[model samples]
Target: MNKTVNQKAWFLVLPVLILVGFSAVIPLMTVVNYSVQDTFGNNVFFWAGLDWFRDMLESERMWNALGRQLVFSGIILAIEVPLGIFVALNMPKKGFWASFCLVLMSLPLLIPWNVVGTIWQIFGRVDIGLLGYVLAKLGVNYNYTQNVIDAWATVIVMDVWHWTSLVALLAYAGLQSIPDAYYQAAKIDQASRWKVFRFIELPKMAGVLMIAILLRFMDSFMIYTEPFVVTGGGPGNATTFLSIDLVKMALGQFDLGPAAAFSLMYFLVILLISWVFYTVMTNLDKRDGV
Candidate 1:
């Protein structure tokens, strides 16, 4: 006789399914509908077919935004990943300091994205902000609003301050999973600090590092609120990544059809990159017998 399964579990999952349907599926459907059609005032719509998609594809603005986005994400990842790993490697393994450091690291992650933007906005202000004031006192010219390079630097530094903690925390967790015995073994082999890290710690942390990379990449690629709040994609659109461009097209310029198409393509690019990361990570895990 076959054993009975917990078919009743479906009842518990039903609410979550409904919530997802409302939150994700419905909005997604709405976006799809808008992407394929054009609309005017009074809720009137006209069939546009693939016209929007074609236009977004051929648009130089979209390409420029996408290029800027890729560059920003690349810069963020390049700086953050290595810095996070280095910080993690130096954190206390056990004791009060460990707990203290962990809590400190998590504080940045706990702050709201908008709040992070606001905090940094004030932080880099040329008037009363500590950073700006200090830099100016030192005879340094620093103005995010006026200079594109300053705006980009401020955004990247803000991101590093806000989210590098996440990577460090992940790497720290990966470090924790390594048994003390491994360190003892490395010591027995008379391994240098770099040797221990390169041979033992790095291998173990690879999984979490991949996760950190994926998270950082996705977050940086789609980043909007912070930069928007700080720069408003100003200084001649120097920091106008794809999301800002999408907002500009949809709301600023009030071009719905092209905006929707641009958004869909943007979503696909993110999805595709995320898939590649997931595939590489899973394969690495398999190879390492993780």
Candidate 2:
């Protein structure tokens, strides 16, 4: 029996498709065009083929930036995931305090990225900022602008403060979805806290945790505004990530062709890594029967 398919849904989605084409596809096409051709003012363009890509691949500056980016992302995931889960596990399950705690946890995520960076910038000044002044009084040699280790620590702490709440909130939501029956059953079985968590909660929260890991990974990998504003990719390029280097090439030095190629490679790396993360997590979930 053949029935007529309803095609009306296409009309509703047409606007969104057109918008995406204009916003994403058009800009990507322009980047591709710029990446393959070199311009010598007066609107004259010469075919450069894959020269820019080859140069970027061989460049030590790009490699250094990539290493820094990878380390930052790895540190963020390691700290934020476990910390967030711990927080969610300790949060109140219900009532007024739950509401208050939820609001408090959301406060950091509500602030603008640049504003967060600016706030930290001021808050870390040794002469005036509360944190720095106190540390100085205690004789702690903490200077993000001068010391490489201090700069890395400050940025890592800043990101953890800003984004850990997001992971906690997601984990909290996952916990909320679990039925009370599971806990009751665990109690009846006289299962230990660790056993219950391993057998029940961990498996249940795996999906959301995977989501949190992926989101944090992608965001940390592509991070720009906060660190740029706070450290300005300084302290002798110790904090310079790929995004900062790309900006220096495209705008600071006006190396459009190379910058475009660099950006495309950046995009591909993020995409590839994200795919790997997704695949590995999905396999783990399947193996665990989650």
lDDT winner among the candidates?
Answer: 2
lDDT of 2 by residue, 1-290 (tens): 99989999689999999999999999999999999999987889999999999999999999999999999999999999999999999999999999999999999999999999998888888999888788899999999999999889989999999999999999999999999999999999999999988988888898999999999999999999999998999898999989988999999999999999999999999999999989998887788665
Record all residue pairs in model 1 with backbone atoms less than 3 Å apart, i.e. clashing: none
Candidate 2: where are CA atoms >4 Å away? 5-13, 288-290
Q: Write the per-residue lDDT of candidate 1 for residues 1-290, one digit (tens) a residue.
A: 99889989789999999999999999888888888999886789999999999988899999989999999999999999999999998999999999999999999999998899899999999899999889988999999999999999999999999999999999999999999999999999999999999989999998889889998999899999999999989888999989998999899988888888888899999999999889988986798775
Q: Worst ten-residue run, lDDT, model 1?
A: 281-290
TM-score of 2: 0.96
In order, what lDDT does every prediction score? 0.92, 0.94
Q: Cα RMSDs of all predictions?
A: 2.0, 1.6
Best by TM-score: 2
Q: Provide TM-scores for the models.
A: 0.94, 0.96
